[model samples]
Target chain A: MNNKVALVAWREYVVRVRRRTFIVATLLTPIGIGLLALMAGYFSTKGAVSSKDILFVDESTIFRSADPTSETHVFRFSDKNISEERDNYLENHDVLVHIPPFENLGDKKHQVQYFSEEKLSVMTINKLERAIAKAFKNHKIKSSDIDMEMYNSFDTKVVFEDGEVLEKIAAGEEDASKSGKLNLIIGTILGATMGFLMYMVIFIYGGMVMRSVMEEKINRIVEVMISSVKPFQLMLGKILGVGAVGITQLAIWLILIPVILWIVQSTVGLNDASQAEQMAEIAQNMNGQTSLEGFDIGQIISEFQSLNWGLIIPLFVLFFFGGYFIYSSMFAAIGSAIGDDMGEGQQLMIPIVIPVVIAFVMLQGVLSNPNGSMAIFGSLFPLFSPIIMPARLAFDPPMWQIALSVVILILSCIFFVWFSGKIYRVGILLYGKKVSFKELGKWLFYKA
Target chain B: MSVLQISDVVKQYGDHRAVDGMSFNVPKGSIFGLLGPNGAGKTSLIRIITRITGADSGDILLDGTPIQKTRVRDIGYMPEERGLYKKMKVGEQLMYLAQLKELSASEAKKVINHWMDKFDISDWWNKKIEELSKGMQQKIQFIATVMHEPSLIILDEPFTGLDPINTNLIKEEIFRMNDEGTSIIFSTHRMEQVEEICKDIVLINQGKKMLEGKVSEVKQKFKENIYELIYLEGELKNDSTYTIVQNDGQKASLKIKDGLRANTVLQSLIQQGIQIRKFEEQLPSLNDIFISLIENKTV
Candidate 1:
C-alpha cells in the first residue's frame, strides 16, 4: 500500500505538472496577478478619474477663497438673489454646489443644496463636506486675531519627545501608509493563499480525477484497476498522483518566482538584491530621520519583513495541504458518486463548499483580530481554519491557537478521508443513476 | 482453484431485485461467460464480486476468502461503458491508471508501452482519449484494465463498439489470457460470441439464473422433445401425442409429448404423407434459450 501510494503520488505529480492546463494556470498566475495589481494601482493612483467642476456659491467673501481653480470655482453675490450667478455658472460649469445664506442668529447650520447633470464622485462630495466644516471654522475664528495658517495645519502633528522615535511617529505617516498597507496586505493575502487555494484547486482538479475514475467504474475500467491494486491503494495512489501534479506545478512556480524575481531585479537594476540588502540593512540601522529624504527602508522591509512569518509560512503550508486533502477527498467521493460527468459532480461539490465560502467572506474580519472570538471560534472549526488561520497569522496569532487550528485541520483531513473513501468505493462503480445528497450521506455512514 | 465464487448472492435496487440469489464460480484458468439480456443482473453480480457495491445478503469469495475492499486488485473489470479521461493523453492516462493500481513509474511505462504496441496503437501514445475513435479508445481502455495483470477479470460487454477486426483483436487476447491461466467472467447480449468462445456460462434473465453449465450441455439438454423436419409434401398436424409448434410450407418443428420421441414425430409425419427431406432434433441456441426463459418468466 505504501509503495502503491508513493507510486500514485509520484505519477499524479508528474502527469499533472505535464498537463497543459496546469502549465497554463501556473504560468498565467504571476503575470495575471502582476497585471491585475498594475491596473488597480494605476487607476487608484490616478485618483479615481474625476475632472468635473465644483461651483461654489458664497454670500460672504470669507466663504470664497482666493480665486478657486478650474476644478473648484467660487462665485460671490452682492444681492441675496443668487439665481443670476447660478445661471451664469450653470451655462459653463459641470455641477452646482449651492451654499445658502448663513444665519448665525442662533443656529450654525446652512441650508445647502447640490445639483448636477450627473451624480458626483463620493470623494468630491466628501471634499465638499470637509470644505464646509473648514468654512464653519473660518467663521469661528472671525475676530480672535488667531493664526489661521497654523490652525489650517493643526490637523497634523509631529512629536519628538523621549523614546526611539518610531517612523510612524512622523505624524501623517500612519494614514498615508495605511491605505498602501491595506492594498498590499490584500494582494499578499491573495498570493500567499494561492497555495492554500490549491486545496480548492486540488479538489476541483482531483474531483476531475475521481470523476474520471467513476466514469471508468461506470464503464468498468475500475474493475480492471481493482484486479492489480487494492481499492485503498488505488484511491490513495490517485489522490497522491493528482496531488503531486498540483504540488509539482506549484513547485515549478515556486522555483520560477525567485528566478523571475532575480531576472527582473537584474534587468531593471532597481531590485538589485545586494543593493536592496544594503538599503534594508542601512534602514534597519538608522535611529531617527536625520534627513528624512531617503527611503524608510522600514516601510519596504515592513511589507517584506516586520512580519510574524514564524507563524505564517508553517500554517500556510499546513492549511494548504490539510484543506486540499480534505476537500479533494470529498471531491473524489463526489466524483465517484457522479459517475457520469463533471456537470453532475458539481452538484454535491457546491453544498460541501459552503463552509469554505463562508469562511472566505469572514476572512477580512478574521485578519483584523486573529485572537478575537470570531477568528478563534472559526479557526477551531476545521473548514474555516484552513482559510481563517493563515489570514490571521499575518497579525501574529498565539502559538496555542495556531497549534490548535493545525491539529483540528489535520484530524479533519483524516476523518474526511475515511468518510470520502466509503462514498468513493460505492460511487465509482455506480452508473446510470443520478446520485442524490441523501443517498451519498447514507453511503458515508454505511457499514462495510 | 476457483478465482471467484459468488454464493447465494442477492442484490436489490430499491424494490427491484437486480440479482436474486445468484450463485456462480469462475474457476481458475477459464473464460466464464455471464450471458444475459439487458437488465438481467449480470452487472449486479459483477458489481457484487468487485465489491463496488455489496450484495444485500450474500457472499462473494475471491480465491476462497470473502472478497473485501482490500481484494479489489485481484480482479480486473472492463465495464460495458467505456470510461476514460477525455482530456487526458493515452500514455499519461494509462500511466495515471497504472500509478493508481500501484505500479512504479518505470513499470507503468513499460506495461503501457507493451500493451499500446501489442494493440498496434503505439503511434497514438500522445493522443488524447477523445482524439481517438471509440474503437481506438477501447484499445486504450483495454490496456489500462489488463495492464495490472489481475487474477480474475470481469468484462461486461467488452466487445461493445468494436468493429470486426478490433473484436477479433480483443477475442484473441481473451483466449490468450485464458490459455495463460487467467480466469475471466464476460457478460454480453451477443449469443454467437458466447458459443464461439465461452467454455462455460451462466445464463440469467430478470435477475435470476435461468440456466448455467457448459455451452454444449445447455444446447444438448434443451435439444430433446423438439424436432425440425423438412418434408416435400405432408400435413404437419397438431395431435394429442405431438404438437406442431411451427410449420412453414416444407419445414416444420414439432414439440413431442413426454411419451413421444423425435422418431415418433417422424413416423407420425410420414404416416400423414409428409415426405421429409431432413429429420433432426432442433438444438436450441443460447439466443432461443434466453428469449424463451424471459418469455416464460413473463407468462
Candidate 2:
C-alpha cells in the first residue's frame, strides 16, 4: 500500500471511530441485543403463556377421568352443587364453568354457563371449549353398545381386497413427524437471520462510504487529498477504512453477544444450559404442548448441526468483502459526481440498490428451496450473490455453484473498482453542475 | 540557476485553450511572481506545474531533470481553492498533509511542532479547523505546505482572506524560505505585494506569456521617457527636443523627444536661467503596464 493511502485510511478510521454517533451506535447495538435476549429468556422461563386455572362444576357427574388437555390451562372438578356453592367457588376461582345436567343424552349440543369475576382471555375460553367438546365425545362413545377395543382396532387397519391390511402405525406421516416440520422452521429461521445480517452490513456500510466521499467533496478536501494521493488510492483507502470500522463493530458484537447472553442467563438462574435447549423449551410451550411429544428437540439440534458453516463462513467473508467493495465503490463514484448535493446522490442510489432489494425480497424463496432455479439465479448473479449465496449454503448448495458465485463476485468487484475509479478521477475536481447518468456514462470513457 | 522550467506547455479544454504555449523559468532562491487577471490561465499553468493536471504538449524540468511522480515531494502546492477538513484537529490535519507529501512519521511530527511553534499556533493543536477563523486556517494551511521543506513552493492567492498582520507574517516567512534557497512562485493579482516581494515575474494573458523578466528591467522597459520637473524660476520653452505634455505654472511634465536625453532638456532649461528644483524620470506602475499590455495584446 502507498504510504499516503495508509495515512488517509488511518485518518478516516480514527475520525469516524471518534465520532459520538459511531461510538454510540456501535456500543449500544450489542447491549440492546443482550437486553432483548434477556427479555426473551425471562419470558420463556416464565412459560410461553401463563396457565389459567379453571373450576369445573359438573352437575351430571361426568368427566371423572383425567383430562387430556392443552398446557395453557389447569382443569378441576367441583363436587359441591354449583348453585349452592357458587359463592365459595367464586371466592377462590376467577373463572368458573357450570355444566348443567343433560336431559337428552343423544343431544350433542349440551349447554354450559361460564361465569367469571373478570373476562377470561380468548385463548383460555377457546381451550375450555375444546376440553368440554372432547369430554362430550368421550361420553357419547361410552354410551354406545360397541366394543371399544374392536372399534379402535378396525380404525387402525386399512383393509384391502387380498386381505392385506396396512396398519395405521405405519401411516403416511411416519417419516413426516411433527419434529421433521420443526426442523424445517428452524433451518429457515437460521437462514433468514444470516441473510438479514449480510443485508444490513452491506446496506449500512455501503451508504457510509458514499457519505464519507460526499463529506470530503463538500468540505473541499478532495482536491488537497488527491494532490497527495491518486484518486483510486483515496477511494480505496476510504472503503477499506470504513470497512475496517464495520468489521471491528461486527467482531465486537460476535464476542460480546455470547458474553452478554451468559450474563443474562446467570441473572435469570438459567446458567449452564445451552441456547438450543432453552429455545426448544420456549418453542414447545409456545405451541401449548403439555409434553415434549411432537416438539422435536433432537430434530432442531440435528438441523442446526447440519448447517455447513465450514463452507458458509468462508463464503460469507468472501461475499461480504466483495459486495461491500462493489456497492461502496459505486456509491463513492456517485458521491464524487454529484459533488456537495446529497439529494442527488440519494436519487441515484435507487438504481444501484434495486438488485440488492430484489435479492432480499426473494430471500424467503431462496431459503425454502435452496436448489430451485430462482435460488440458483439469485446465488449466481453477482449483484445478489453476496446475500443469497451464503444463505443457501446451509442447504448445501452444489460446490460448483458456490465457486461460480465467488468468481463472478470477485470479477465484478474488480470491474466496479476500475469503473468507479475513472469517474472519481474526473468528478472530484468537478464542483458545480449536477451530473446525470448520461454524463456518468461519458465519464467512463474519459481518458485517464 | 533555474530550479524549474516549463516549455511549450499546452492545455486545451475542448476547443478553448486553458494554457497555450506557456513557458517560464523559476530560478533557485528567487521569489517569482506569476501575475494575471481572472481566467488568464495562471491557475491552469500552476496546476500543471504542481502536477495536479497534465499539459497536452509540453515538458517540465526540475533541476535539469524531467518532472516525475517522486519530484512532487520536492514541490509544495497550495491551490486557490484552499480547504481543510473542518472536523479534523489542526495538528492532526497538518500532520496528515505533511505525511502525504512523503515525510516519515517522526520527521512529520517534529516539523509540525516546529512550524506550529513558529506560527504561534501551538495552542490550536487540539482545536478543530472549523473553530479557527479564516485567517488562522490560512496560517495553518501555510504551515502544512512548507512543513515538508520542499525545494519549490507554489502558492496561488495564499494571502486571500488574511488580515494585514497575518499577511505580513506569511510574507516574512516566504522571504525567509526563499533566503533558505527555496524557489517560491507567488501567484496573485496583488501587484503591490509582487512589487514588495518578487525579484522576477512572468505576466500571462489569454494563456500566453505577455511579459517575463527581472522586475527592474520590465519596469525600465515600459518607461515612456517622461520626466517630472519642478523649476523655482524662469520660463522653459517647448522645443523640438522636448514636448511639454502638461504645464502647471511651477511644475511641468515633459516627454523627451525621440533620440533626445532628459539631461539635454535640463541643460537647456538651465541655460534659460531656470533653477531646477527637481527632475526625475517617471515610469508606469506594474498595474498600469499589466492592464495596457493585456488590454492591448502588446508585448
Candidate 3:
C-alpha cells in the first residue's frame, strides 16, 4: 500500500479506537449477553422445580384412577364435590380440578373447570388437560372390553435414519445413529449462528466506514486529503481501518463471551449446590415425562468434535473479508455522495440494504435444506454467498460449490471496489447538490 | 527560471468551461497573485497546478518537468474552504498532513515542533481544532500548509476568516518563506493584498486572462494621464490645456488634453499664479482595474 494511504488508515484507527464509546461497547456487550443467558438458565431451572399440587374432584365414577403424580403437577383425588373443595382448596392445594360426569364418551366439547386463587400458568393448565384426556380414553377402552396392554402397544414413534448412518451401522459402528442426529442439531445451530454473525458484522462495520467517509466530507477535510493522496487510496484506507476495528471487537467477543459464561456458571454452581441438586433431580424426573429421551451432552460434544472446522473456520474468515470489502466500498460511495442531508443518504442505501436482508431471510431455507437448489443458487451468487455459504459450511456441501462461491465472491469484491472508487472520487468533492442514482451513474464515467 | 508553468490548460464541466485555454507561470521565489472573480476558473487552474485534478488538455510543468504523482510532494495546497479534522489534535493533524506530503515521521515531528514554537503555539499541540477559536484554527491551518516546506505553495483565499492580526502574521510568514526561495501562488478576489504583496499578477475573468504583468507595470499601463493638484491660492478651472474633472477651493483633479505631456499641464497650472503644494499623476488601483475588467466582460 502507498505510504500516504497507510498514514490515513493509521489516523482513522487511532481516533476511533481511543473513543470512550468504543471502549465501553467493546468490553461490556459480551458481559451483558452473558448475564442474560445466566438469568434465563436460572429461571428455567427454578420453574421446573416448583411443581403445582391440585385436588382432583372426579364426579364421574366411571373414570379410571391415575398415578396422580407428575414432574410439574401433583394430583390428590377427592370424594367431595368441586364446590366443597373449591372454597377450601387454597388452604392446601394450588388448584381444584372438577371433572363432571358425561353421558357421551365421544364428545370433544366437554369442559373441565379449574378453580385457583391465582391465574393458572399455561404449562399447568396443559398438564391438567392431558391427564384428564388420558383418563377418559382409559375409561372408554375398559368399557369396550379391550385389553389395555394391546391398546398401549399401538402407540408408536418413527425415527428417521440417514443413509450414511445406516451404512455406518451396517459396518458395526456403535454410535453412528446418535452421531447423525447430533450432527443435524449442531450443524443447524452452528450454521445459523455463523450466518447471523456475518450479517451483523457487515452492517456494523460497513456503516462505520460510511459514517467515517461522510465525516471527512462534511468536515471538508476530504479536499485536503485528496490533494495529498488519491481519493481511491483514502477510501480504501478508511474501509480497512474501520474493518480492523470490527475484527478486533469480534475477536475480543469470541474470547470474552465463553469465558464470562463459564465464570458465571461455575460461580452459580458453587454458590447454589443444593439448588443444583434439586435441579438435577427435577431434570431426571422430567426426562421420563418429556419426549427428549435421547438428549446426551457427551454425544453432542463428540459430534461437535467431529465437525470439519479446519475448512469451516478458514472459509468463514474468507467470506467475512469478501463480504465486508464488497459492501463497505459501496457504503463509502454513498457516504461521499451525501452532502449534509441524512435523509438523502438513507434513500441511497435501499439498493444496498435489500440484498443483505434477502440473504438473511434466505438463511432459514438454506439451513433447512443445505443442498437444495435455492441453497445452491443463493450460496453460489456472490451477493448472497457470504451469508448463505457460511450457513451451509457445516452441512459439508460439495467441495466444488464452496470453491465456486469463494471464487465468485473474491472477483465481485474486486469489481465493486473499483466501481465504487470511481464514484467516490467524484462524489467526495460534491456539495449542496441533491445527488440521485442517475447522477451517481454519470459519476462512474467521470475522469479521475 | 519558473518554478511552475501551466500552458493552454482547459477544464470543462459538462456545458460549462471552467478553465479555457488559460496559461501562466510562477517565477522562482516570486509571490504570484492569481486574481479573478468568483467563477473565473482561478480555482480550476490552481487545482491543475497542484495536481488535484487533471486538465482536459494542458501541460503543468514543475521546474520544467511535467507534473506527475511524485511531484505532489513538491507542492502544498490550502483550498479556499479551509478545513482540518475537528476531533484531531493540532499536533497530530499537522503531522498527518506533513507525512502525506512525504515527510518522514521524525522529520515531520521536528518540523511541526519548530513551526509550533515559531508560531508561539507549542501549548496548542494537544488541543483539538474545535477547542480553538476560528482565527486560531486558521493559524494552525497556515502552519500545516507550509510545515512540509514544499518548493511551491498555493493558498486560495488563505485569509478569509482571519482577523487583521492573524492576517498580518500569515502575510509575514509568506514573505519569509519566499525569502527562503519558496515560490507562492496567492489566489483571491481581494486585490489590495495583491498590490501590497505580489510582485507579478495574472487577472482572469470568464476563464480567460484579462491582464498579466508586474503589479507596478499593470498599474502603470492602466493610468489615464490624470493628475491630482493641491494648490494653496488660485481656484482651478477647465481650460484648453487640461479639463478639470473635479474642483474645489485650492484643489482640483485634471485630465490632460490629448497630445499634451504631464509637464505641460503643470507648466500651465504654475503660469496661472497658483502656488502649488502638491501635484502628482493618478494611477488606477487594482480594485478599479479588476472591477472594470469583470464588468466589461458582462457588458
lDDT of each: 0.69, 0.80, 0.84
Per-candidate TM-score against the hidden true structure: 0.71, 0.85, 0.89
Q: What is the DockQ of candidate 2?
A: 0.49
Error of 1 at A196 (Å): 9.0
Query: Can you write out model 2's per-residue Cα lDDT over B49-149, one digit (the tens) per residue?
Result: 77666678888998787775445578888888878999989988888888888888899899999988888878889999999998898998888788888
- Deviating ranges (above 4 Å) for candidate 3: A42-84, A97-113, A128-159, A164-179, A268-294
Please give the DockQ score of every candidate, comma-separated: 0.28, 0.49, 0.64
- Quote model 1's TM-score: 0.71
Per-residue alpha-carbon lDDT of candidate 1 for residues A151-235, written as tens digits (9 for 90 to 100): 6776765533323223454554343333333333443454346425744664566565665466556555565555445565667
lDDT of 3 by residue, A1-448 (tens): 3776778788888999888899999999998988886775676545434567878787775443655466545768888877788789888998788888867876766687878877886555765677777877787888778999998899896667687768876788745534455577678889899899989987999999999999898888888887888888999999888888888889999999999988888887623543444444455657622222365657767778778889999999999999999999999999999967889889899988999999999999888888999999999998899899999998889999998999999999999999999989888887898999999998886665
**Cα misplacement distance, residue A20 of candidate 1 (Å):** 2.7
| Share of the reference A-B contacts seen in candidate 2 | 0.43
**Prediction RMSDs, each to the true structure:** 9.1, 6.0, 4.7
- lDDT at B8, model 3: 90
**Which numbered prediction scores highest in DockQ against the true structure?**
3
